[model samples]
Target chain A: MTRFASAQSIAHDIRSGKRSAASTMQAVLNTITQHDSAIHSVTHLFAQQAMQQAHAVDAMVARKEPLPPLAGVPFGVKDLFDIQGHVTTAGSIVLRNTPPAAQDAALVARLRTAGAIPVATLNMDEFAYGFATDNAHYGITRNPHDTQRMAGGSSGGSAAAVAAGFLPFTLGTDTNGSIRVPASLCGVWGLKPTLGRLPRAGAYPFSASLDVVGHFTGTLEDLRNIFYIMADTPAEPEPQDLRVACLGGWFAQNLSPALAAAISRVCAHLGLTGTTELPQTPTARAASFVITASEGGTLHLPRLRAAAEDYDPATRDRLLAGAMLPASTYVQAQRFRRWFREQVHAAFEQVDVLIAPSVMCEAPLLDNPTIMVGGKPASARANLGLYTQPLSLPGLPVLCLPLSNTGTLPLGLQLVAAPGREAALFSLARKLEQAGLAGRYPHNTQQAA
Target chain B: MTSPPFSDEVLVAARAQAMELALPPACVAGVIANTRVLQNYAALIRDFPLPDTCEPAGDYTP
Candidate 1:
């Protein structure tokens, strides 16, 4: 079925005329329409426009014109991304009256140029503020692996769309674990490329310094290929004989037994005997959180003044709190970020990549949304980024690869590298996939039944 | 490191007045709760041993 087909395979088939792009697009649309109710990943389907683009690809093929690498592949974007002539909601109603974007977000335009059709705008947390994609206006995006559980956000819909096989891949933005948290929980491959590596022209902003544009894909190959296309760079060869280390201390603590075993498996496979601790991890995480709140709050302060009532209560409250943060506090967080980045960069001197858990455990149940932190059940929304937020402070590239066959729900591991070192992350992810240690977690049909 | 004692009500009142925000009465309590969370996180950052020469990361120009 086209629903779960990799973007690379879809492009090959379309170019080979094994299937028309129109049929592929229609199949994805039909599948989304039929099955999306259970998961609520999609907020708006670009049916007519997507079909037209698919037809254009077919026409090009008919003329013997060269097809782009991702020709005829359907993908979705987090609702925050501007998709030309459509209003970017950024998962909030506060901007509902704002004019439609005049152009596609930079990455969306790049992907379109590479022949990938944007099929839908996916769900996300209001203003991309929450880790859980439980939107006050749009409703929650349920985990496909277990519908009763969460699909992590504000990129939750992007990850869920890929995890549920609705699209080959989807665009998302990460500022403090939006991409990694959801990708980990939903059991798909996601990448938060090095900060500023990919342009962010029209993606709605949150935490300017920390915001990174990236994507989620069903397959590692798709993730790698689309990443180059979006980054507008040729694939760099991954270095062989790369040094890797596991992150210990704060990262090693408060993990579920299943997650602990999964990390151990990865470590044993790589013959990693010792762990490298990032200096002041708890402070790193706290600094990241402070920066996010301050920046996001400041960005929305003007609107918050005018129409705070129009915002989601959860998001509005956080933004309000962020707006109230003293300037000294925001400044100090940025100072800490600079220091933390240097410390993290120094750690790379000893290792090419650092391995850490994407989340402490699997997706928390929606009915009882809590994750264990320090031997107590903590609010899932507040603590889900326990691991990811610290890493964000350094602006390093992190590939969130889903752990495979853990005999439990999906767990994800972060393969992290220094800035502009995504190749190493990709290389390590490929190795893990080959070793049967990392890959997409298949949707649980038994659980659904 | 201990943070200086701060009043949530005072901070919220000043923010509301400065931003000209019309926060609903219902939202104020939630905002205050979240403000406390921010305060705690801010304390952590404030306590980090950063030297004065360490500038905030600005536009990166290679």
Candidate 2:
């Protein structure tokens, strides 16, 4: 009944009769009651349903039936997914008129099939469009490490919920850096699995090409467990000796001294041999924006044209601008995607995994909007996902591993591998976590407001 | 950066071609202003001599 015991740990405890499923549920409910008023990470709770699910898991265990990996573990889902009996708002007021879903998303169903409980639907950016979960519609999802600073988004609430110890794990969607950025900001581990590795049916559509469902966890063991249950791959053993490539040039350039120092420390610890000099990422980032805006713009053109005022102003103009993009340009963006993936794939010849800073800087304050990283003024929304967007282009599996300490704001280091090689990435992450290179929300960030 | 020869009216015409929406005259300026970012990306692509035969990933229909 530990509030922050991982899903795997909770399941083990439940199976071993150390804690009843009801007791665990009570602990979670108590934690939410005690902490959520100021945190507000959860938007809506399915308390009764969660208890029902947990009890069913207990009954199964009592019958001596083999339990699923996530049996009796409570989970928080991002607001964007369609959970049966709840409205899938995706954090926008425009969707207020939509009716409750009749069924769960394919991913949600898969998790439930594995015996995980959906305790609540967490907050997110409107339409999954922003970097910070500072939605004009949902207010803002604050960082658990520092309430004043932003939790990277549009999966901010999911990351913050796990970091705040309300839930040991949560489900979120990453388009661009939604999962990784928040994982970095909140000092939690998160994974954006290979595209189509998990089915997307019933999740609200963003950009078809880039949208990926991901999960957040406090430790690499939880991250790997959740990923194994979620991804379309066989789990592997904990990492021993695997070659890691430190991405240089575009991925490493212009990072803040603190973040650069942190990445340098991680590399030094790993004894990483650098490889693969990527071309300038600014062009790749700009190209990614074009792809997202144009696709997102087209997808919402009807709503945009009729109820433009209903959209978040931050995303509104971008969608409208996307409506104006040339067909040839969209085609060009796709061509660039192919070329970029090929370029990245060619690098795998020399190394097993690639690593980079998840973001160029630490979480910025939500109230004070503009961000300055490495002496350059950056758009708080667009620039926060700088290290993440290009990888999203090729639909690679990337893990956001948090490296910051107790008193400091969180920063992340990203590990990526070949599309179906989630086991490799998880293996490496587990090793780093064991070495104390990555972990949960730091101790100082654990204070309740 | 010099503004592209393409004017706001032309870009709006292209947007209008893709969708049906009556825009206020003032709105055309905003779309074009925001689209300047795309032009910067275009400039970046222009720097690379992409092979004419290059194809995009996931471009083919399943």
Candidate 3:
């Protein structure tokens, strides 16, 4: 069987006599062990525990007990998510001596209940701080499509593992585009649910106000199904008629030629002729940055004070700067956020889903970590969230999906909906997937483990 | 935005002193560079006009 199977198909195989859960788990672990050398997506593997869980699934099947929807499906958690008994390093040495978690993170616990096995702890930016998963403690998570290129962070490892077909799905957290940017760069399906819609318990905190718990999947169906399970909500109907519009002005500025052309194709398919623009787009992005830095810096202030040397140099510097930001700056940014949120919320009155590029371009090369912004080179680490940061300001639900066959490494698009309207995002993503306009590019050719 | 309230080195030294957190010699340069980035962002939203009624978005005042 091809290792690039989706979670749905894996579950089907396990439920039927097509494959044993134990064998499926072994194949997944073996694939990572043999193929993850270059990608560095996995930090630790729960080999023994995963195998034991798999055998139990096989037993359940032999007994003819009803199988769970995701029975025997293997997935990975971003290192920051607590996986009971394992010390959640959050990709830093500072928490190395911290106690092991008493219980699974809320979402992890939910997946475990659904019979999904947590197979590994994935790599990420330390404490989920930077956009680049260039962790100081753990090595960088290289893009599966092009190893020399980046897998955007701080959720880089989670995205790369799915892109590599090492796991069918993986969990990630987004605060100012952690989930969207990497999923875009890695060419996978990702969802940033409405702020606080999903449980955040046991997941490591970054920015209290902006932080969100989400996941990345290889296919749109798995993305939708797993979300409902984690949300503990019944599946909502996908609306057939969606009021869709492409975002303009600030969102329209950057173009990588190919990305611009692809966007045009999707807009044309949707019969969209004009674009809707958000008010004061640049300032919105600035507000997102300010809020995230302030909250994240404040959250880690105690630890930073005690053990600043334990942090990744880049993360430490950013947190240090964030901690010292004037209280007025934080308050003013929040005030701006209120105004900006109202403006966007009003825009939703006319449009059901807004379309935008997830990243300005495909993943950047590791050697030259720069992206073209305003026709000038800009640091990828800082500017990768140009599109995503603004959206985060309003706590809206966004779905980032890879555009298929862009003739390069992977480029992605974002489908945004009003708060609590994740169903709308999925409906539009499904239509694009059917149109052959959005989906993951096949990576199984290189290492069809 | 161009006229920052304080010099980077001066502000860092003062903030460090007030918080009683030691700024390691090696970390100062990186911290200053990052602070400069934040200063530019702070400038962008610093003076934007907002209605007096606008409260901090998610900030709850009990």
Candidate 4:
């Protein structure tokens, strides 16, 4: 009965004794066991530990003790997040034999403190390097909306779990659109908080300059609630009269008709007639790629030397290339980032939130694995981040909300705001959600296998 | 900045050896293909000029 339920509603159900946490946890595990074979989102299910925690919550409920806001709510984390007693393989075989994590990842610890149970560890691209969650070691995590399409990564499993309703929310890390791209393709709400806005203490590092720990949720409410709980800050008030603009130039190009029309509807609702553009966006995207490759390559250089064969070939080549990149290229990308951040910050001063497409098209079919770019097919793994990569350069907070009633599979739009302006993005997203512009993908219409 | 004149094959071989990473024979082609792609990106960033005062976005605390 708790399957597909929002975290907020589940917590409410447990606190009111409408359902025991044990039963809820059992139901969650059952649903995942039943449905996840199609999506392949889950990697390791902590069945016994999750049941124990759920029973503990039920016991506390019996005592009429004050419950944390999300007590007994089930959630998952990308395999990279440390879960105390488990090895964080980070979707790679190289670390399969490493020691178990000494403690839970910081955000996971916060959620546990608030009574949320860690239900499972989800799949991802090997070493968090690729856009396609087509992991050779873990098996591909298929898009829940359509089993044959990709669930974008390196946070693909986290997003797919939420999209498939296996978990109310799941933790993910985004360096170059990992969260947003998958969240978009999977038809869920994803937040990439301002750089450093949330702790990344235990999430496996990838592109340290760009990595930001965030989460994917089926509902906007859970996205907001869990984010504040993880950030350990009281929620900021949402501004009513917000300045919003849609991004043009690089963002406005190469869109599917449905996504472009959806953007039109939202802009028309806001009475917006003018658009804004970020300068040198293509270069910004390029810079994002170079920096991620270089940093990620450097991080694993030592291991790659000893155990390169253990890595997924799709990821191994990219990491090796990234590792081999010249230092000047890496530095120039960083320098461009500095100038670009100033420009982005200046634009933000005039607007509260900027709207853009999260991914240009709907989920790309796993068989084809390409999207139209300049009227030609391009690799989905490399180009899925076209819009998202440019935004990552400045480390702005971006909220990817699935557009409602779009074409067959789901389409998503990005609500980007100034650094630390997640509240503004949330407020704007809520407006679109209330206006019938955005919501989770309809399960009734899931793509056929 | 001028890029090295060697071919991508040479680049991979030289870099792997320099880093003391013994690239497996099977992995060479894939690595070279990836390197070529990144070089395009590298050229883009290298060509774009910034003010002399522009520094690497090292702090990453935006």
Candidate 5:
């Protein structure tokens, strides 16, 4: 197995003339061609265009021109993001005949401008609805750690690609744990920045209010650097001596012994003595779900009416039900959302960051397709977002960090902060990484002897 | 959570007519099951007491 390099390391080598950009891009494409079959993470590869872009970066370097921060780094996007002249299928066949996108999505355009080449479009849950990336259109994306288990999707492909070491980073969206769940299961560093912190133009919509575009990377530094580049903002310095707390109540309930122990170790390392509770967490989670269903259903109602047969059976059924939701219910969900946001903001007054488990356990087996929720076997597709959904209600920044040395499949911990305080999350995650408690799960071939 | 406001028969009818959904007969059962789940979630948010002053999150100016 190839040892994957971070975006920072790749750019450093290219900029110093230690390696040519074309060679790096070719290697990435070759790796995807050779290895991606086992994981099924990539949906479409842009080999020719990516190679041309890599040559352009090399030309600039030869001419002694200033290089961008991400010069020649290869990245992938969830199929929902539009790349110029390419059809954005959004992991479904319904849009197969649609005209090619005239331009890149807003964030994609930003990454391109910074010299990161888009090499492929990754698979996702059809229409970004389910937690499992079991698209009827695109075959299910199996976890790279263990092919029989799920990758924990709608952004499963994005996480799996990074976990498989095929790309330095890949873009994904988090509406209701789409990014976090997959990142947790795949053991990659994923960031769902504060909602609205990154632009979303040209990306296919799921829930207008809940959708957040983010990315997954194998390194914490890469996650932070790429986030600032996409946001087009200068990095904010992380404040020292930040107060942190563990979340209890709903977040504390479900746990595999390994996951619970991991969280305890993190808390112990942070010296946290007690846990903070999010008020009305179950209700908050419920509100997030209702709002997502209503918005997503409303957005796709016209398409469902016209081409209902073109959708995945699972997605079609869910969207049909969401469309039938009473108007009063959607209104109430929004109302409750406003109230909940205020309560969450107030809770942030006492702690700068909060730590919680990203998923209850490791990825569930594809054959069983269930997770132990509240001590009962529940559908993984429905309940994988139990911890992530409530946090989504407030649109806070959450960094899903993979726990190291857990002696099992990947388990992730969410380092959450108030809106626009991603620096705090980065700060906390870095501390954990330095302490040998958090990092990417090494693939079998890359693990030390 | 409170009980769903509509009966199963009513919901099935509403899905076809009001929602303009034309799911196959086999698909109807799954749609109905998912609708029940959404309704349960909606019920949890519906009863939160809010003043008349509370406004929906529209275009967030901030």
Candidate 6:
């Protein structure tokens, strides 16, 4: 078996008596013990809990009890998510002292119910704020492909852990591309479910409107299985012909040459037409920022006002600015969100899926002086979210599939489906993966470069 | 319905009103520069023509 086969394949083996859940759990724990020193993907691992859960699953198999959907699979949840009895740090010291959660977050609880054990709480950007997973409190989560490069943020640790083979798949949240960007940089497949399709009752809130619970898996089958289990609602109607539209304008034309080439390769592989003109995305990204700031500021106003010093300096300033936004501006930004979502739907009417670069470039070297794109100096913060923020506004289910060779410190093309249409997205992705079009893991960039 | 841009003095006052913890002078300067990003976004939204039927985001009720 491939060491990092998708969870669904592993589950099939476990259920068919070819592998025991206990053996899979032991293998995962051994892998983490052997490999996590350099990657630092998981912050707090529950070795005892995972083994205990695995033992129970094995006993169920022996007794001929109905197996759970994800029986014997291991996964990681971002630290921002509540996993019951652990501190939900959200990758900062401020919440480190907070009381343990009485129950798992909805997403975590769902994973458990599916028979997947969350082996650890992975690291993330502070409060899921930044695009680079350079947490001040927790050391940065290094890209598994190249130790020196970054794993895209907020969900970086989740992506890196999967890339490094610590787990087959992991759970993450996306508010403005946290899930997709990191998945792209880390060379794995991840999905951002449509907003509200997965209940957000327990995950740490970034922006109520934009924040979405998503997951990272290496294979298309795993993505489909996990998505079906995670989404609170039933599957929606599937689309036929499954035509994908290439989104150009800001994301495609303005992307770095390397990223543009990667997207081109993905389009060629899928036999999709590349278009030059698409909806204005830069403006949509701008609108998303305004809304995120206003809502984020409001969410953290009390804490920010009380102990601003406790927050990471980078996120602290952003929240403080959010607190200072005029009410009218906040209202206007929300109004813009509605219009933007409608415009996104308009684009969907023309195609079943819209494909674009997950980020403007490949993973940049850690601590680079400045991030430059296409020879143009850009906001290190703003540019990371440029390709992702527009889709986040509408809470569209986005699947990020890596395109470059494993050693290239991979880039990805994003497939965004219409709202609440995750099944359709998965169907298309499965088609691509079956045709050897989607990217997969074991992408060891370290050996090549 | 563009809101009047807040001056530096107003920003400083707002900072005070918001009870920002004592930040380093350099950090304060950085905040000012970053806030400009926010203000530009504020202007973009303010300039857009929003539908009259647009509703506030919150818990829905009958």
lDDT of 1 by residue, A288-374 (tens): 998899899999988887788888999989988888788889888888888888888888988999999999998999999998888
Report the lDDT tens digits of candidate 6 across residue range A1-449. 42576787778889999888888888888878878889889898899998999999999999999988888888899998888888788888988778999899988898898899889889899989888888878888998878888888889999998887678889899988899889988889899987777778788888887888889988776777788788745555666578687877676655767666666666787787757344546557777888788788788878876677788888888877776777788777767776767677777787788787787777877766246766787655567777888777766888898763423567777888887677678777766666665666455433211
Better of 1 and 3 by lDDT: 3
lDDT of 4 by residue, A1-449 (tens): 87679999999999999999999999999999998999999999999999999999999999999999999999999999999999999998889889999999999999999999999999999878888888889999999878889999989999999888889999999999999999999999999999998999999998999999999998999999889999999999999899999899999999999899999999999999979999999899999999999999999888888888899987888898999988999999999999999999999889999999999999999999999999999998889999999999999999999999886698889999999889998899999999999998888633222
Would you list the clashing residue pairs of candidate 6? none
Chain A: TM-score in each model: 0.98, 0.94, 0.99, 0.98, 0.98, 0.93
**What does DockQ come to for candidate 4?**
0.80
Report the lDDT tens digits of candidate 3 across residue range A178-284. Answer: 99999999999999999989999999999999899999998999999999999998999999999999999999988788899999999999999989999999999
Using DockQ as the measure, what is the rank order of every candidate, best first?
4, 1, 5, 3, 2, 6
Interface RMSD measured for model 6: 3.4
In order of the candidates, what TM-score does chain B achieve? 0.72, 0.49, 0.80, 0.82, 0.70, 0.57
Question: Which is the better candidate, 1 or 3, if ranked by DockQ?
Answer: 1
lDDT of 1 at A138: 96
Q: After superposition, how far is residue A446 of candidate 4 from its true place, in Å?
A: 11
In terms of lDDT, the poorest run of 10 residues in model 4 chain A is A440-449
Off by over 4 Å in 6: A232-238, A269-280, A404-407, A445-449, B1-10, B18-27, B51-62
TM-score for the B chain of model 5 = 0.70
Q: For residues A337-377, write the lDDT of model 2, one tens digit per residue.
A: 77777776777766778998888777888777566756777
* Docking verdict class for candidate 5: medium
TM per prediction: 0.97, 0.93, 0.98, 0.98, 0.97, 0.91
* Deviation of model 5 at A428, angstroms: 0.7
Backbone collisions counted per model: 0, 0, 0, 0, 0, 0
Off by over 4 Å in 3: A444-449, B59-62
The lDDT values for all models are: 0.90, 0.80, 0.92, 0.92, 0.91, 0.78
